[model samples]
Target: MSRVLALLVALAAPWTPLLRAAAARPEHAPCAALALSPAPAPTGRPALQDAPICKKCQSTGRLPCAAHPRSDCLLEDEVLFCSVVADCTACAGAAWVPCTDCDNAPARARIEEKKASVATRRVALEYIDQTMKRPIRKAESKHFVLVWEMDRLKVDKKWLESHELLHLYLKRLEALYDDYCARMQITDKEFAEKFRVFVWQFPQDHHDAGLRFCRQSAKGGVKLMGQTPSYSVCGNKQNFQDDERLHRNIVHSVTHLILSAQRPVAWIGNIKAGWLDEGLAHFFEDRYWDVCDTYCYQEANTNVDFKGGRFRLAVRRMVEEGKFPPTAEVFQQNVDTLTLPMHATAFSYVEFLLNRDAERFNQLVKKLKAKVATRDALREIYGWSVFDFEAQWKSWVLSTYPTK
Candidate 1:
């Protein structure tokens, strides 16, 4: 077999007899899938996209033994942190193995590298008063800073504060963040820490000022509903005078920002597949119904009022017309190449996977983020062969999707 084929075979069936023998041997007591070798600190900024994946650990930045030079372990709180599955008799202390699904390399090297460079290239903040004739003011909570043009809003500070609606909106955003962390099964401390959000709200008179602040054009692609730049974590909003539009846009854009700033596809030097990427973003867009705190429920087409239902309906039409791509093809789609139908299909596919088993879906997210091959990761994580996944996913879609 060719080297690539051999690797695929290994990935397809990781527990082969040879690997079993190696694991059983006393010298290689804990069978490690990948080998690790540490080198000196990289000179200058090493290519973020060029970090090599160890065949043993699959670029997870983990290893079978703390003795391995690349075994990313630390002596924290008198515990011997290691990624090995088996106990390390050498260190009688506790071991801190990464969740088999988690990928630490991006956190360890990629984010730290980019953060250092990003911190140096700061853009000056533009105050609204100097640019626009309207009365605009800024208010901030722990994670978000909002600058709004007073004339454009139906609800003012007095009304918002009195109704506690302003607090509720900010709290809603916070709840979204909490929901995200809970789904990923990690804490805020465990993720990349740069999460401060700045929102620029431009009512009618202040919309021009918002554009000027962001240095954006006033027409064409300048609808500028909301944006989260790849270079920074903040989002800019324009013309979202309605409460629902504002809420939906904030949830959507902020989801992208959090994913970018946290597990960070940039750190991996690759973009995620469109289906999971956009689907997760859309999924968060409807995580809460009308309120953030009280009685939240699962988001689905038959049940939820979120826009994802529209996407699911679009996907259903494609399915009936025989235009929807196969599961394998969808899995391979890049965001740049995805069509509108593809987006709909991708979102539904993610929802399908999530509904089947959310924990497994989350594992698939981690594995994919680590740049594991899609088919290999699916087999390893979900234990579903390609044939099984396609058949089941299609069946689930036709049955559960709304026809109306």
Candidate 2:
């Protein structure tokens, strides 16, 4: 026979003889066959005395040891000898040893498991790159890397993209503010010095999980939402995706950032009152909403009923009545709760005050900023009580836009 055929035949030989030997000399008979070494070992390492003759080796062997890296001892009678060197450079210095019955299956299984895990990780990373608008950089709080899950961000691709873009927009807005201040001859050294922005995207749990969207740290570090307002984006299912809604959400959230950035020294003292802080946010964001309305006119569709028509009437009435509320009261009675005849009332009221009389309104805001006390500040700015301001606003509404 040819050399290759002869070798094949030798390897294909039955293990019956080896099995008989095992039965006859159970104590010393090999349990597994030896495979041939691919290359000769260096001088130092011990070489196999001869090809192993275990039943498994004889039945399945080609040359050195097919099971050299691993073998099994069957009962106490059968000794499966593995003949491969543990640290042969020819074998890439890999250790070869008999597989223990206990760990053989698990070891092989672990290899497969690791392979799958690597594949999953690759997929998740690709999804993140394709879905996320910007690269998510690692954030540190003390020593921990804020490691979070992918599912927490319940917002979809568009929503997440828009949300993160808002963060980028804030940086742009800061630049814009710096430019505006410089051109207007305002010394913004103090204004620019007050706030530092920190963008966090936490893993979310569910669709509507509560993630901390935006918060001002005690030390004045601002955390802006990259997903929901209060929840982390690690474990949530993403769903938010209406373009208009997304824009509104971004504008609203960034407006908070801007106001927080420009927070006056006096307002900083009473920052705990939810009404005052949130109301101011509302006031600023409401104005921003108008600006967005004009800028993105095609996208401007009223999602909430702000009683705009009724508010216009109320403002007209208040103007005719020559009465307006102190800035403090407007800050006190949350703008959202204050009633109006039309849907856009609050928005219209803010628009009229800020757009028509920005100077006077800014003056009132400054005065309120100094006073801090809602009632006292209101009295000082508008010279009207809270109730009187409402009446005048309503009368103004009636006078400006008559229902009949």
Candidate 3:
């Protein structure tokens, strides 16, 4: 390791296995009630039988954890389940403490249940924690768990601390999840596991995560695009120069994950379905960044010079010039084998079908997930064979795509 990397790891907080806090419960002797010198005859007034309710916790038997990482964990809806935060020394992921003033059995029991769940989740979701020896920061949204090791981030012309950026990225992931589900009509039950993402500042951590999670040995980024898709990238100046660029990287990778995990729980990237695999990822990249900056041929840096990564006009030009390949030929390729130009045509195919009718396109995806051929699925869902699809898509491109 280089001196710079060594220094950063040294600066990071050390991580150890979750250690249960050990403390003796202090015993308190019950105070003897001062009996009236002579037991007075009971008045007609009702006896004071109940313990006073804790006004601080609103009788809920919990107070917020001390030093709560609320700012980092904030989202539109409350983040009720997070493996990383559940280990907070104060509340143990329940985000509350027992209210000492009142004996609310139900509330205290609920907190205990949450604590137990936290411990279980922490053990199950130890992706980066199990791989990296150094201290790591973590955050989660409904669909994604983020492992962040980058110390600082540049967002909107200003720098944000690591904690601030973690929440921001979590929010971004959820936003994309919402869009993906809405477009595909996918429900929460369709997914098998929460997607895992790791952004590392050092090459070693990135490399280790790539091997462990993605099953690939890559220098830039590696993603496992199956049922429980995971992505790990070395987020340094060489691969991602700025925050906006990094955001693009993740959206592109996560799009691949969502499509693979939607149904049938398999990645079609290698099953002669490269057109949809690469096309859908490019579609989302362009959707958010207004440019398709990177291609997933491999997890390496790409300097796409085709119209500055803006492919709509380029694709239109290809169709008009008769430079585009046959639709059947493109459909026969896999993710790792697609040439740069073929990727552009792939995006156009998805654009043509999804824009014209999303419901039909969704049906087509379900068919594909079931191992049906693209041509067959299209014929069944869109009533078009390969030849028919090619003709219609080219005509649509000529009519709707801008010439500029």
The numbered model that scores best in TM-score is: 3
| Candidate 1 runs further than 4 Å off | 1-152, 155-168, 201-238, 264-272, 288-309
Clash list (residue pairs), candidate 3:
none
Q: Which pairs of residues collide in model 1? A: 33-56, 34-56, 34-57
lDDT of each: 0.48, 0.35, 0.74
Candidate 1 residue-wise lDDT at 292: 21
Q: For candidate 3, write residues 1-404 as lDDT tens digits.
A: 33533443455334110010001111211111211122222443212222354688765566666656544333312443564466678777776777777777777887888777667667666645756765577766668888877878889989998766777788898899999888776789878889988888889889888888888867877888775688898887888879988999899888998888877788888888889988999898888877887776655665655677878889989988999977888988998888777888898888788788778877877787777889888888878878888999899999988898
How many pairs collide in each candidate, listed in order?
A: 3, 66, 0
Q: Report the error of model 1 at residue 351, Å.
A: 1.3
Q: Put down candidate 1 lDDT per residue, 1-404, tens digits, no spaces.
A: 33543564478474354443333343533324322322222444332334444555665553333642232233221111111211334332122333244466544453344233222321111233455553333323344434432233334333342113433455666678788777666566645443333344323333353356444433211212123321111122233435565566567655655665554333211344656766666666545542221001121112323334466666667777877777677677665465555656666766788777767876777777777766787899878887787777778889987787
Evaluate model 1: give its lDDT.
0.48
Model 2: how far is 100 from its true place, Å?
68
RMSD of 3: 14.9
